[model samples]
Target chain A: MNGSIADPKAVRRTILRNLRSALLELGSATKAELSDRLGVSFPTVSKFLGQMEKAGELLPVQLDDSSGGRRANRYSYNPEVMLGLALFLERTETSYIVFNCAGEVKDQGHAASVLTADITDFDALIAALVNKHPQISAVSVGVPAAVNNGRLIYIPEYEQFHDLDLKAHCEQRFQLPTVIENDMNAAVYGYYMARHQRSELQPSLVYLYFGQNGPGSGIMLDGNIMRGSSFFSGEVSFVPLYDQYNFGEAMRASHPHPRFPDGDLSVDAVARLIAVFAAVLNPHGVILSRHEANEGLLAQLEAASQAYIPREHLPAFILSDWEQDYLYGLQGLSLDLMLSREAGGN
Target chain B: MNGSIADPKAVRRTILRNLRSALLELGSATKAELSDRLGVSFPTVSKFLGQMEKAGELLPVQLDDSSGGRRANRYSYNPEVMLGLALFLERTETSYIVFNCAGEVKDQGHAASVLTADITDFDALIAALVNKHPQISAVSVGVPAAVNNGRLIYIPEYEQFHDLDLKAHCEQRFQLPTVIENDMNAAVYGYYMARHQRSELQPSLVYLYFGQNGPGSGIMLDGNIMRGSSFFSGEVSFVPLYDQYNFGEAMRASHPHPRFPDGDLSVDAVARLIAVFAAVLNPHGVILSRHEANEGLLAQLEAASQAYIPREHLPAFILSDWEQDYLYGLQGLSLDLMLSREAGGN
Candidate 1:
């Protein structure tokens, strides 16, 4: 029985939710184990498990060792029972990944850049992917813009996609749960989740990127993405780090490419930004892409940062693949939607 | 019966916790109202209420009007059942407030500056307060330093208080639960709580203060204090906002007093700091003490900040009483401890 002793439908929802979470955590569990863990009766667990199995949400993976009687069936969540579609719309290309509930990628591809095209192109691309993967249960898209609850509220040059309720549009068209996240937000979440150990531990971190879209950051404080009051938490482009120029203008003046610039001006700006993070946030780590933060630049940054703040206060500088982290983040969001949907018995 | 069908103690704890929160929300409620809200059996609620009433933790407020049935008795949580001692150690003086669970100030006073004096002096002040208020159940101390889990890990001028486990020491000495918080954290929380409407709505804000010691800030995001990884989230004095000087250095160079300076340099620096918050945190409000901000200075800051970031992204600048907010925040913390203790039936 649900602990609250609420309405029956609400009780069932709570029981199924707990059972699903336990199954995910345990990998596989016999009806008795789930019953013991959830404090639900054995018959209650058995009924839900039977219903879920009939709905193709669970599978009998193995048999529990018999003590003195018949062996009990150990059931596991069907990893491929549902699929998720993850996509990122970048400056020049649109990349996507189709993954299962277990986060295993089944297909990956690229399409034309949606920023310069119409919303229909983006819709058609998703439709194609959905048709190919008929089991797709959720969709998550990442865009380099300030997103407010799935609406592209601020997109400087991407006017074609500006003010679009991407989540609502996609959900309506595909009849699936959809999430739209800011690019940097997704990247930071992906980076945070990529490390299995760190995923369990909430680590405050800042992921900085000088992308084709411009300089931006993703902030994760205590394991949560800090989407600021106006959903502009990671828009570091306008941060005035100098007397005459902002971060974006200074970066553009120092270098043409997204790679780390060796110029003193650019170096000072990056070091100052890191120092600001150290003083204000004091995060556990400051993550940067390997393409933008080599050993030599990292060394220079560490030394330069000490001039502004104490060395002990600085966070660890990490190098990661931004592309991989972004896709992983999108996949993670999609998987969450699928799990909640399943728990809701939708 | 307990709904969990497991540990009766745990179930009782949950029900009591829920009941306490509901009563606090509803102000006063009848036994049947609590039983229906908690989804616990009427007998269970009746038993707990009876025990709590006998313990003096609850009071029979009045009787509800009969609706062709028995007049139900409305019970309320006893506001004076426990008291909380809240104190802040400042450069010039130590201010304290004794408040009850209902947030009514029972007493408030100030003592000699604890920074220059010995920790014994601080303890004596608390002892005196506790002696007078025998019902004091929790203690909360706010200090101007980085606090990691109630330990004063960073105290620049006050070396005597450095590395002191204030919470543990106080709890042991007074035989009451204690909490130690950073001064700015308390101030921001107090400011956040002072506005009852905002308390219900989570608004991201930064409370900046330039005091006798130095400049510090408290950050509130979605209604929770942003205590960074190292418990150094609001230590913004070292932020290298300018090439030659950090925020503190620049401010000191521009002004002698901890007030809004008329110099253009200070104005620019303040504007830039606001711009940084705009581009990064984008908080709903940037709070400042009335002593440190005025109409003329605020206008200059608004104009100067436009050079860095767009006007649309700027947060509303708010002026509040720093001292009041700090004390209120400490009281809020102590009240939380008291509430949890009452719910635990301890």
Candidate 2:
């Protein structure tokens, strides 16, 4: 929508894209209902639906209620026609989920740390999974490093993946559409999506993590995830929350891996970090990994941050299942890719 | 595009909106060119252009080149058909710019501080301006506090305007579309637009100003200006960059109003703030008010910030005319409002 229109084919593609998106959201509707919903002509909707039906993309659900006229047949999208793969590469393990367009997870599994091994191990893992699920049409990957449009731009710990275009590789290898995102970005997006469905309110949210790999954050304002100028947003480790030390240095000095707030120093550091997000972003909430969060830590953070800013201005501190959130976010991305690929004349 | 399409009327409105936008950007275009550029049918473009021409919204510009075919007529948008009013209510004075659709400044003036004066003074100022320029179709106002959808949610200095839907009041009184934005938000947006046209690269930028009112910031990440939950973003005064003092407290303690970094204490505080944005956002640039920034001060900041974070990660710090940027941003918002209003079946 931001660029110049290319041609009529592109315009038709957009209509089909909107129709598919409407159907996905509506679940089932009559031809007239879809035409009205899409603001497109009845003939256009009828033609596209017929074409998709022939391609096994649509299912006849039921007959619409008759209102003193002939009943129209209701059509539903075939969720099973497209499958998505979502995976996250972590230092200890690689986890994945295979899901349908409707977000129903069909299978989930884990593999050895592909980051420590090599790119071949990453390839083999995806290859094996794709072989198992032939219907998988799209893939989304989550990584611990900063990602620039599917390329690993900053992976100091994993040299094997550094500078690799993981999305291009996966898409080329499997002939499937793929996307690559930072782990924290995906996690926050997943959390935002889960909560957004219930409230339907745009939220400003932050996801923070002190992981085995490093410290990072994910920022979402008004439901849009922020990837910085070079996709370097959420690299909170570099944050100079204190004059004496950066967030990462402070964390490393005060605590051990995974379990944070080993002492008051780390607590102070984490609290200061929370205050930074509160003051700068004023998000609705700040989410932390459930594994590292508890009632005690949250209360301590709240009390500590109050020293810097008013308590009322502080965002709500929450703990979420980071693993689930990350995978769900990846799944969401993959499903979108599936839809967009199909809508782009697949 | 994100919402359910309502009907054919709404769809027609969207096509018209796109056509208007395309024409404005292209300056002038032939029917064939517009159709190809908008991905709409030739008949649709031709019909709408004819209607707009009849409405005096378009002007016949020139004829297109011919290559073994008939030459076509090129049409241009009538910039004089619509005008916008952009005004910023500052503590010192209220500055205004009456601009046409093409961003040409037709008139500029200043009035007494509306924030310090009563609300009637504000009304009278707008009335005088609108009376002089009867062609004005939209209004955009910039204020010094947090804004939530045009309502002044946080204006502690001006209690009379607090919680007032300034946009609603302006539109109701003037019978024109209106928008209200925060001073810093408008400034950053204006600067972004000015730079975006030249480079066309989406930028992550920050605008910082220590003014007579208070310290605040504007954040634009990847071309989107971030308004946080409750619209409390850019309140950088509360950011706890130091254990001993917040940014506002440190600035007030070391420096007088209108000037900054008068001593080492304020310098350290400002550097720490820049470091915070860098480590967290990794923005491409951080902009400062030209009035406050000097070569000596910037050098001091650049060196001091390196004490907190790496030099390479620090965003490029530059001085900008905050006043011009603020007005330009408001003008842009007003123009968009005008177009959107005309496209909404007006």
Candidate 3:
């Protein structure tokens, strides 16, 4: 290790990195506590904190009383220093969200349902985001399609987005590196990160997100998104659920006699479908978002599913708090990118 | 670096490790090739090769012909230097396999009609394996149950093996480090590793192993097993296919006014059930196998499945050629362990 390579600039960067991580994990910490954690002398920690404060990276916050001593000033990372831009696109609408370093939604904007095939609206969406959030450092867009090597390879259901150079376009427009991922993958990551933060659960997770037409599944193995070969591994909608019997005929047959003509396969039908699918995948849990999920219908479907499977042993199912799901995913992607960059630097 | 601390013992281990990986990937190499690949001097490669040959770890193979000069003698790692013991346990039978360093099966043995719930039989299975292959170095067992952190946490349909201390029992009997994994996990790993070796197509794999009563699914995401929280993911069989519709009712509804009056659901009915299930999961491919997946039955099942799914764009469906999918999984586990160990050492 060359002494010159460990220059003041490099040392300062390392100190900042350590402080950022500590703040991210602990929310806030005192200079003394950070010094002990970083194994740096108290004076060194104080000096770095001073420099970071001057650089507008850290903000001083009032601290609680220390044991029998005067209260020391605590420091927290400035949320506005860097922002993450997240774009979530579906069949009906395009949503853009800005999240701060602490995974909090700083701002959000949405555009009316735009057909993905007519990507003319995509440019407008990006333009709106850049204009709204000038401090955005990186952007991650979620598409209802398959992405391979950072390229949108296929969106069979949403054919318009297929073969689109969303990554290059976004990067050039925003002047920031961009990543485009499968919406299901993003949702899964978002759900997993949220669950992990809230509970003492396992590191690995499988999430099933139900949409209008079909359900999408995302798997996290060993604490990382397991993007299978060609990045189409988690396309669970294509997973076969029923044998060759006509779905239409089965639905009709399930309808009661003519006197009690069965109502349309309401939200309940979809929930039953989800429950069945969940039974098959046996994931950690299934997450239903109100944005797309028919909660009342799923409850009825779940009851039907129990009757069909006759097995009490099944993974838990929950409805995602929609207001937070997409935003949470966006924040998680930002953190993932930051962590990867930091790890690479190390 | 202290010269004495990095003596022949350390040097020899490193050289052997590098040589093992090179051989695993490239099969064989000349001393000069090994020297260049290992980034060691030619003299060091020669010395290490000589020592390895003396220790029976390296074997001199046919020479590689040069353009005009003397041919170069190529050395290969001895596959017998390390052995992997693989156990595949089913409801009624247990298959034991010993694999060489290169993942080729050396020998196989079997025990019949042993119930996993019966402790004596389980112990006898382990005893039989130890008695048969005393030279086995490491053991990997595949149980038809869900495993969480090496513990059989849930077996779903398997009433007997739920929450059993399988790893502990195996370790106690064998007095060797052992890995106990769910049968589906092993199947997925086996399929992934086998395809990687045999084909250039990097398809996302979803392996469905049809047992006597039902089927078990193993999902591979990005060439890795999608183990969920509690290692209970991929239990696709339990996914509900019909709501309040029994197998007989589902069949009768699909084929109204059937020629036969018998209430028994035909194998075709089961095939239909499978097809419907497959439609929901939409895997890149579906592999049907069992402890007894013979060629004749496999062909019939494949044909029937094709007829069941109406979608022309369905994923490829095939039958596993290997009789012992669990053995292949064991081989994969051993290979993974070896690769991880080498990675850690480096």
Q: Write the per-residue lDDT of candidate 2 for residues B302-331, one digit (tens) a residue.
A: 998898777777889888899789878898
> Per-residue lDDT for A295-324 in model 3, tens only?
675566567557544434444566776446
Single out the weakest 10-residue window by summed lDDT for candidate 1 chain A: A255-264
Kindly list the per-residue Cα lDDT of model 1 for residues A37-152, writing each as its tens digit: 77888988998888888887887568888989999999998888788899888888998999887788899999889888889899899889988988888999998888888899
Task: Report residue B121 deviation for candidate 3 (angstroms).
Answer: 6.6
Ranking by TM-score: 1, 2, 3
As for candidate 2, its clashing pairs are none
TM-score of 3: 0.72
- The Cα RMSD in angstroms, rounded to one decimal, for candidate 1 relative to the true structure is 4.8
lDDT at position B303, candidate 2: 97
Selected candidate, larger DockQ, 2 vs 3: 2
Against the native chain B, each candidate's TM-score is 0.84, 0.87, 0.67
Model 2 chain B: lowest-lDDT 10 consecutive positions: B255-264
The sequence of per-residue lDDT tens digits that candidate 3 reaches over residues B1-346 is 2222123455555555666767776788898887776666778678767766776677657889895999999888777766778777777787777877788888887887444456677677667666776656667877777776667786655666768787787777767567888777787678767657422455556776555555557776556566654454555545444333444354344444233345433355445445544554445666666544556765565676666454443456667743456567778786554433322231
DockQ of each: 0.47, 0.40, 0.22
Please give the lDDT score at residue A227 for candidate 2: 73
Ranking by lDDT: 1, 2, 3
